[model samples]
Target: MKILYAKDFNRVLDFLTINLDGVTLAFSTAENDRSFNRHKDYGINNLNSIVKDFNINNIKYLNQIHSDEVLVYRNDFENITDKEGDALITSEKECAIGVFTADCVPIIIVDDKNKVIAAIHSGWKGTYNSIVTRTLEKMIDEFNIDIVNTKIFIGPHIRQCCYEVSEDLKEKFIDKTNIDRDILFKGRNLSLEECILKDVREFGIKEDNIYSLDLCTHCEEDIKLFSYRKSVGTYGRLFSFAFIK
Candidate 1:
């Protein structure tokens, strides 16, 4: 229930200090924001301010290939990639991870017991490739994190009510995973949220452990959720971020 908006960023250090358990979760909105995310292949320098304020020195980022590849950030200092991938996970508290999004679903995973966290960017491409499932697997294999005990928060994105797609796109979603197809497309509704939640359930994550923001970025124009589809071509992105405190 703790949500931080873009305008409140000036108080980042103060916000993080108010510990609802030192796991400060914050994300940027499309409004009152400043970031150099003009290039699709880069992150914003403004985000560096957040990282510094949060006391994170080791930052991890990916190129976002849109495939099922989950990048693991292990080192404290090194050159990061600009390649295309979907997700990132790390147990290092020394840094924060970044995921830029216009309308893509950004996810945060926190295993409070083990002090592990994950940041994932899931679009239709990532969803079809089972990126959520892949993230769960990586956590188990690498950090010995118990999926049953982990908590996940699904951030705002385009909801099925407005996220219309072609039959070809729908077909790819169906072929890529085993899900209740009826909920996927109800005449014109393509339930990406439902599909992702379903995949999370399939990965043995408890229903209670999954939290859905349930807000449609496309529908909330004034709120600045940054709808790439709505912008057509000209717009900046809201960088979704998460870290261990």
Candidate 2:
């Protein structure tokens, strides 16, 4: 669970292989987008081109709805009619999987031995709905993943420094999660990273195994990381993905 900056994108493969023998996970920044069609960039043609870079046999994806729903990826999960979920998972070898997010948290979990991986898109709504918790539960139930042995990584997004909220939202989060209301601020600022970390821990992931990128997209506009709050109507998006080798 190493937090590598985009400066080291060239070394991404190296890091993935060194960290785990059978799997790899990564989060892309705005730099990956050439034309920058945030919604359509991850379309079929684009996904196919991206898949060629890796030796993965198949790539599973989700129509993320920013809800607490966690969908397991198997023939059955794929065959379902209405495709709507916030997370995706796969145990197939060389099976790459992905989930897209702009400023929302990208939650990744990998089981080195079982060769299972999961990717989750957790926005503030998804966070309050406990999407991370549901994703972990789905992993444990569907794949029998060992919570203790699994590795989890939370990618960069809106940090509290820039994620100011209204009092209504703050109180709602506190009531829903029952987190220490003190963590919410007088200015109604909340740390999405901290909230995700707390949820990951509550899901039985160890503190040491949970790594996070404190990069605040709003604060670092120069990096071109998308910030819904910062960019308003001009914001673009990034994708975070994980796969079993």
Candidate 3:
């Protein structure tokens, strides 16, 4: 697997593309010429352009309520509206699944043997609920995926260097994971990435199969990545996509 930062249309837009066997995965950054402010309708054009550029015939996204809800997609499923969930799983080819995030973690999971792919949105609330583990378990139960052969990609997000939480929130993770207080609480903050990785490992995903972009959205001032904590009401979401080719 290789992680690449790419530009298109004469370097007018920037994207993070992950290259894995039989799959092409990507995510847009705030630097893209088109805005991704989902509340306004303008971002739809950018999203459409991306779909066209990637030649994706069908795409599934979510309402993303920060819950652990998982939406499974099949070619036969009728499209009424985008499902309200934090994760999307699909094995169909030519169809892409994506999720939007600013500071939250955007994760992509792929089962190479089964051609199953999943896109997950894990905010602090979702992480506390073990959204990643739930999504993997759903794949195992529904698709009969082998965790040892699956590849997990953790995209750019606010890292521990910049992600600070209140004492109550810190204690919540500690109580839930039973991790040592000193290790869970680093400096004045808790590390969501560490917690999520722990959960993924617990779900039987090999440590070597996991990869992290390690880019901190909030700390990288030079990059035009979105950060809700940094930009507050003005930030737009970054789009993360995954599909089987």
Positional deviation of residue 53's Cα in model 2 after best superposition, in angstroms:
1.4
- What digit string (tens of lDDT, one per residue) describes model 1 on residues 116-185? 7888888888877778889989988999997777887777788887888888887777766555678777
Task: Give the per-residue lDDT of model 3 (tens digit) for 103-196.
Answer: 9999999998889999999999999999999999899888999888998888879888888898888878888987777776777677777778
State in Å the error of residue 10, model 2.
5.1
Residue 140 of model 1, lDDT score: 88
Whole-model lDDT, model 3? 0.81
Instruction: List where candidate 3 sits over 4 angstroms from the true fold.
Output: 1-13
What clash count goes with each model? 5, 1, 0
List the candidate numbers ranked by lDDT, top first: 3, 1, 2
Where does candidate 2 clash, by residue pair?
Answer: 57-94
Question: Which stretches of model 1 miss by more than 4 angstroms?
Answer: 1-20, 36-43
Residue pairs of candidate 3 with colliding backbone atoms: none
Q: How does model 2 fare in lDDT? A: 0.70
lDDT against the true structure, per candidate, is 0.71, 0.70, 0.81
